[model samples]
Target chain A: MKVPCAIVGSGNIGTDLMYKLRRSPVLDLVLVAGIDPASDGLRRARGLGIEATVRGIEPILEDPASYPIVFEATSAWVHRQNAPRLEEAGARVVDLTPAKLGPLVVPPVNLDVHLGAPNVNLITCGGQATVPIVAAVARVAPVPYAEIVSTVASRSAGPGTRQNIDEFTKTTSSALAEVGGADTGKAIMILNPAEPPILMRNTVFCALGEGYDADAVAGSIVAMVDEVAAYVPGYRLKADPVFERDTYTTPGGTVPARVVVLLEVEGAGDYFPPYAGNLDIMTASAVRVGESLARELWRAAGLSERDGARDGARDGARA
Target chain B: MSASGKTGEGGRPAFRLTDSTLRDGSHAVAHRFTREQVRTVVAALDRAGVPVIEVTHGDGLGGSSFNYGFSATDEMELVREAVATATRAKIAVLMLPGIGVKEDINRVAEVGATVARIATHCTEADISEQHIKLAKSLGMEAVGFLMMAHMIEPGRLLEQARLMESYGADCVYVVDSAGAMTIDDARRRVAALRAGLSIQVGLHAHNNLSLAVANSLAALEEGADQLDGCTTGLGAGAGNCPTELLVAVCAKSGIETGIDPLRMMDAAEEAVRPIRPDQGVIDRDAIVLGYAGVYGSFLLHSKRAAERYGVDAKDILLELGRRKMVGGQEDMIIDVALELARERAG
Candidate 1:
């Protein structure tokens, strides 16, 4: 049987998740829940013939058996309240907000490690864009300080993003340390209002300690970009990593061996325009996590791989 | 030649002109401005009675790295030359908080950069607090630049501008970095900022949509105190507002700018115009970029990406606008072009 999933928000990220979920073979998106009756997202979901509700999570709360997995794209404050309720009802949760209530997950870096957790938090967009590069650099060298600057189109930044600016920087920086394996991390976001809005560009500055292999670090970063590209096809490097032998003057003193890498994420025009790589990376990774979780649940239950596909086929035949 | 400040209905102040020939004008010359070139532009602008002359790489201070092309000469050397040559105009440096740090500010200030334009994305003004404070501490006139102002509503822009004002900015600018705003957009934002902040408000415009001059005038009528321009509209994308044109307009409108329009025209035609790669005019790429509300700096990057990916540049710009991409997302050009090429291939 195909795993039934419900998306618990009908914003850009949630609606994008619904479209990607349609392409997944393992999970079926049954309902989209939101509080806004006249939202474009709700209209789009209804147009797609999915059961969408403006009553928020009540629909899913009442019919827990129908939704075994839930994707919470609401704000952190909302998720903080809804997560426990979903867990009580025996539904797995993928929290897409900056809520750190669950174990942090980045599909390419550490998704598999938190598979069994009741709730998994996909960090902020900046975290999704830069942490992998930090992880890739840390794989080869001990990164003492890693700083990421993410510049996205201002139009791509929604009201939620504007209000949560502080939380985004704090969460992304923390994820850089906890998940990206950095001693200290700093995150800065720039919303470019340039016409033909600029694509999502990320600049990664990693301070490598002595006795580190530069070539190995480059190789690892390339490999990691490919890994992320598996899900986000537009994720690629603008140029080879640039290295400078310079001293960084900190509040304490000076540090050496600074390597800077520039990355650009082009979204796969799924639901957002291709320039919304920030949104793309988040939703794309969520799909990766959802599909993997679906497969994991199937295996644990001794269900065959073809069983889910067969169920989807039977559903399509019935429809 | 009108240096007289004719009072408005409510005695609103006249606009101050900031000549950006050495800074934004670099894009017109492919960011290869020599120290002598900067000195020449600075001297002429100062002699023409422009009050402020911004000098830095086209992308701002510390933007001379590989990602944003390497300058023909070092920026510090150029700053020194500008300081040595300008007679009356205050020297300024544009510093995005991350790209240009405290040390960069100190270096420029030490060499006599009297104004520091601390720029950040419109919604992220909090990040500019430190830089703005540092500029004030250094005794430099600090201006907050809310880049991509078209991306937010007037109330939101006012909030960001208030944060900059709270952080010690003497003036706050509504920067149309993409030249995408209509006259009403500029008027609404300037009016909001005027009502909200006690500090002075400025306007910066790009000519991507052929509305730079009109938007600047709109903002001026709505209580803008400072305006930025480049000689001959020689800057990024379709370039900035033409300095001579703005001065001429101010004169015609009986609003004093203390600038000689004839001198500005001489500077544009005799000095800056010869070195320009192409005169600033609204082309197809620039038009689409303006219509789609894309960043102005992405024009060249988009064109190159389109050529490399074998797709139409307009298609790339339209797709970028559809996605609501911003200034630093140059990499998406290639992604959009590739996607377009793929669709054609299939």
Candidate 2:
């Protein structure tokens, strides 16, 4: 028996997931939900030969009377609004927002725990990307301090990200503490709306308090990131900058800045390579986590729709 | 009487003034100062007790649109020639934030160069700190320069100042290389640089809007002892506060400038004389840049926009600097210029 699933948003991320799921074997697509009448989700559903329904939050929450699972792709606040309704109706929900309605998940760190939970929430994007690196750091160097700077395209960033700037810090810290095993990671995130958009979440300056196996630590971090990215998708590593320079004018004169370097290592060593690898691993892990949620939502809904038609055909033959 | 009620150079002071002609001033001319002319000016600044002669590389580490021409010069020869009768006065060189390593820095410091100024722009303080630390580590008399001081407040500038000072900066300079500051602002900036840092404060003025002399003098009066000058005011955007004027102002007032003022004027004429006609003279665009306190980088920017979007350079420069430019619109200016080029190309 297939579990009826509902995809509650048809935005960029949602649409991409739908195509991926319809082609996959594990899950069925049942209901495609949306908030706007003008969403491409409705048109896409029709193109996929899936049922087209008008958009509303109430309809999606009510869907579990038939569709018994929900994938919430709304903002954190909206997830909070829809969480209890979906859970009480006996539908397990997976949320894409930073809001933690239930257990937070990343496949490498908590895959089994997430599968076991009736409702699961993926923490902030930074949590998904940097947790593995943090775990790696603890294994080899054991840190007293860590910070990640996840600069994003401002337009692509979710709502409440800018208006509530403090929330970005709070959410990042809370998520890092939960995953890193020490409630002490800081996040300084920026939304650079620069042209020719750069998509990189760079983590810098992880000071590891001495005593541990740094090579083993880096390996573990890389493994976790690779594992998560394999299961999910869309996470990739970018460049590492060391000895960065620019021109600065001071009261004295215009002096050229010839060397500025920040290094992250799991041990007492000071260099740029360790932190560069750490940042790449962590970011890749987080992006994959998001990818996995999309896959699950699309599969469950599509399979459940198929199951419904099959049941109807069998009933007619028996009659 | 000057606008400040006195020639703001109103000071009795004793210090060798160094005009960064053909060096820091290279940015005004697109870093292609003719070889003969560069040699003439560098030699002249040395002849005058302007003492330290600084040469090219306005933006270090591939930071600028082009590299400085000094790469072609035999650096050792250039250094020796610029400081013929080496007194305590030295040949100074500058670098941008990310271009060279500690080994490279030590090499420059060893090759007859006494001071190496490493710089970072205002928004890049967090990015600039580590480089300055490296320069200090190399045992170079490292001076950290923060550009576009007008865009940032005194307090925020102080935080960076203190850090550079902590990293062993012998001097931290406030650079109005943009020429966008008033005399009062210069004083406040000088105070800010000295407030939290133990290092001495230096002032490098750009002669945009004819305010360089006033601002530099104001900075000196407000406790800045280290200052930058250029012979014949040959520098970026209008140029620098004149070495001759500073020395004369210092000398006529019975101030103790070790520099010989008359010697500096003679050097200026010698350096100002015609070189190969193929190498252009003081530019018209740089003059306009000084009058408006705008960067003389408009031409380079246009050239870039042209390459990026395949449009003509002249149009991009004109539209980008039009009224839409702001107090700190460096990033926006480039973006708009590129956009204009794209639009025209289409």
**Per-residue lDDT of B66 in model 1:** 31
Per-residue C-alpha lDDT of model 2 across residues B1-346, encoded as one tens digit per residue: 1223222344433433556765655554555555566566765655565666775444442222212212333334445555554454676777653233334456666666667776655434443455566666666567777766665688887886776677677888888766768888888988777666777888888776677778877876666758888766766555678777777776675556667788877876666524222222334444444444454434344455456556655554445434323222233333455466446656
Span of ten consecutive residues with least summed lDDT in model 1 chain B: B1-10
lDDT of 2 by residue, A123-242 (tens): 665566666556555555555544555544444444444334445555665665576654355554544333443343435334443244445555655565556456434443332211
TM-score of each: 0.60, 0.49
- On residues A5-84, what C-alpha lDDT tens digit does candidate 1 reach at each position? 99999989998998888877677898999999988888999999999999988988898989988999988899999998
RMSD of each: 9.6, 16.7
* Model 1, span B1-346: residue lDDT tens: 1222232434343777898888988766656888878877877788788888988988788665433444777788999999999888889999876455577888999999999998887877876777788889999999999988998999999999999999899999999988889989888998899889999999999898889999988887777888999999988788899999998987788777888889888888887888874777789988877778877777876776677668898888888888776555554565577678878999
What local distance difference test score does each model get?
0.82, 0.55
- Provide the lowest-lDDT 10-residue window in model 1 chain A: A245-254
Q: How far is candidate 2 from the true structure (C-alpha RMSD, Å)?
A: 16.7
Candidate 1 CAPRI-style tier:
incorrect
> TM-score of chain A for each candidate?
0.94, 0.70
Please name the candidate that would achieve the greatest DockQ relative to the true structure: 1
Candidate 1 residue spans exceeding 4 A from truth: A1-222, A225-319, B1-13
